[model samples]
Target: MVRPWIGLVVLSLGVVAAEPPKPVRVPLKAPHESTIPEGPVGEAIRLGQKVFTNTPLHAPKYSGNALSCSSCHLDAGKAPHAAPMVGLWASFPTYLPRAGRVGTMEDRINGCFLRSMNGKPLPTGSEEMRCLLAYVWWLSKDVPVGAEVVGRGNPPLQAPAPADPERGKAVYARACAACHGEDGLGSADVPPLWGPRSFNLGAGMARTSKAAAFVKANMSGLGGSDPLSAQDAYDVSAYFTHQPRPDFPDKVKDWPKGGKPADSRY
Candidate 1:
């Protein structure tokens, strides 16, 4: 029997001819510090950058762990493929599968505090929140309202095998121990990969796939010399993510409408 898809493929000459064009992704970039306007708004932007780079130092009351906003975002949220905030202002209020609702930028930020920071939410009208919004707005000002930016998040890799923690332990010992420590309790400069002081179970980084993606792309830091294979990245990610860390009691509230990711621990 002649299948329906085979007939469509023959009529179109190829699958490429039947598909819609993909959107062009713009390069990720943030304005220079010198370009910040001279006024109260500028002051807010600077403070926001500080908070992002040093969340525990700037927002101690709301920071449950030692990690900062930049711990994951990297380069004050300007670096590509590390979850850059360059085009974020124009991207909300967007729908989130976890929350099962359309959320504003403020909602997203507070979500980070509640989960990633394992801390309390910043009041929408608080100084810290205002400063954060200002900083992100400035960073995203040059981007068009709905333009797609390349390297916005950690791009996933196709692992040759399913993630394996035993293999990951070896990868961590060889590649990560020097900086993150054998105990996984990172130093004052580096963020801990796992432990009570690290991000809680609810944080996105808690997922093996998310952590693997980030590790594969930027394991050491910005401009790292060595890169790991997809399997190594997955293995190391699985090893660390399965280690003990703070738990999110409210995790039951996530994915209220269903669509919970397969990698979710709880």
Candidate 2:
């Protein structure tokens, strides 16, 4: 009987020993850190500088043209009628009447290649594109995002006729040169009207067709006093289009191989 009692006690002890303990719950907290690395911002800016002036990215056919992003964007910051790329990233995914849709920064960059650069469109989600976006974001940090950018910091559009280049040159020299400089290398508030910083002949300055139509409806900045005539627009555009373009590499060896050539519209 004692032995049976001993066996029962042993069995009870075994059962107690075999039972699992209750699990304790602990709350988890996220670490205090940034998702992106600290140095990447600077790196992105550097990479953007590289991509801006690289013509090789256009490749094959457009290789003859020495144009780069800087060719139009200029110093990667201040440009007028061309849009200030500095604060651009914050406002993207914004609406564009031309496209009849909202577009992101990437969309705008690709559009530049197509419309302004006269090159093929870059692939979406590409590293080069992302770097460019990052640079723009970094530049635009202080500027408010999503604000409507009308007339590109200029006054309302004028219905007057365009000015002649011969006449406009005098106008540019007398009225505009104080701020824009003789060569249209504009000061801080004013932007360059020509040089690598100016708009492309095919896109912003294209006088023949669609681009001209856009300019006629939306051209701005006549000092809020005398509006430019249609002829004024044509002649000034001629002068700007004739301005020199910057030299950049003809081919991008680093671009991924087997990439398709951009569509003809670019």
Candidate 3:
């Protein structure tokens, strides 16, 4: 009986030892590949390319100049100052120290038009605006959407209305052509308003109305002489909006990150 009891105890202990420990759950890793396909996104990118170079639609304010969105953006939509036209749509509605508020891609583009293109703003919620937005979305494929992308420098003073393109042409002849050139292809020091070096409509000047407002408040330097009236700014913006964009190279380049350069005053 003692031997039997001992054997039973050993069996019970063996059964206990054989029992498996509770299963532990491990988290799955994120997929390395993108879910979005290249076909439709590619089409949108092509459309964006056209929009970027299409200046006649916005009707930039300056005249006697052939400046277009492509002038600065370089190649279909590549440039140093502006980020790559791809995989960036996912980030926006981000905080900007320059503007002192969170902004969308539209706000960034509007800011560019006023300061860089010297153009007027496009109205909010317009078809043109949406189309431009669509293009940006296409470029940013597979990236997280609506994340903040900080800019460089205090945002250019809010853009004002565009000057009349016809009048702007005259202004270009008198005031701008010497430095920007008749083609609006600025040199290294000046930076071209339209061409490979210019910002794309989608990436730079999509929001026409906002861009206009900014120009009205400040132009020709923040506190300098020769500030343009709202109407004058609008007209000039209209003229530049209509110009052609330059073609981008096959490979896109990276833009500088964060707001403002260390050496910048504003």
Candidate 4:
């Protein structure tokens, strides 16, 4: 007969640790400019690209901040991990917890205007809205409805080490201040990270988790490389996200049914 200690060791040897789920990501497949079909529809796509790249020049009234859509969406929403417009047509008409209900594609675009741009929404029937929809639709063509696209958003960062805002001040000085400026007011080439022109508290990027993930992937800004350590990302993100910025009066209405993120300023 086996001894009790031997049986216990055998049982332990047979146990296996659970494996983590594999992350899903598909390669970005948005059409290139040469792929735009020839005709009025193609012209519309071109116009939409211009509008996306030059919001201040095209939709000034609807844009309050200096930040262009390209600033975050990079490459006119074609770049992966920059919230590419590809597959968006298939992803929308979905539920948003912040909206507390399902919403249309147009509704989602308007939400970006109010928070990310810190500006008024475009009219539903406006030429700008139509052109934008046309371009997004063209980009998303042939994508199956409800299919998740890889690189659609910033990759989720592992839960960061506890952040320290005090340490963040130094990190910002060393890494971020040159481009964003010590005051965070921004320059002609960079968008303000905080202050009146920056995204409001209701904006998703205002959260430390969201900001840190973005920092890890894209905060290289002009350099276009991620140089910050995970801890540095967490600390600096916390510091800047907590800085003064525009406030959204309607934030009180967010997550009306509950499930607010712990890091949400509102």
RMSD of 2: 18.8
Worst 10 residues of 1 by lDDT: 218-227
What tens digits encode model 3's per-residue C-alpha lDDT throughout 154-176? 13443343236797677555555
Q: Give the Å shift of residue 34 in candidate 3.
A: 18
Candidate 4 TM-score, true structure as reference: 0.86
Consecutive 10-residue window with the lowest summed lDDT within model 4: 218-227
Evaluate model 3: give its TM-score: 0.39
Off by over 4 Å in 3: 1-47, 56-66, 78-82, 144-266
Task: Estimate candidate 4's RMSD in Å.
Answer: 7.2
RMSD of each: 5.6, 18.8, 18.6, 7.2
Residue 1's lDDT in candidate 1: 100
Residue lDDT tens for model 4, 1-266: 99999999999999999897554545678877788889888888888777788777788889878877777788888888877888889877889999899998899888888888888898999888888888899888856665668788888886457988888888898889888999999998788999988888888889998998888777744354347888888899999999999998889889987899999997
Q: Once model 4 is optimally superposed onto the true structure by TM-score, how far is the C-alpha of residue 170 displaced, in angstroms?
A: 1.2
Write down the TM-score of every candidate: 0.90, 0.48, 0.39, 0.86
lDDT of 2 by residue, 101-204 (tens): 67777767776675465566666666677777776666555455544333242233332554345765665554456666787666544545556654343354
Each model's lDDT comes to 0.91, 0.51, 0.49, 0.84
Q: Candidate 1's residue-wise lDDT over 52-105, tens digit each? A: 999999999899999999999989999888999998999998998889899999
Question: Is 2 or 4 the stronger prediction by lDDT?
Answer: 4
Among these predictions, the greatest lDDT belongs to 1
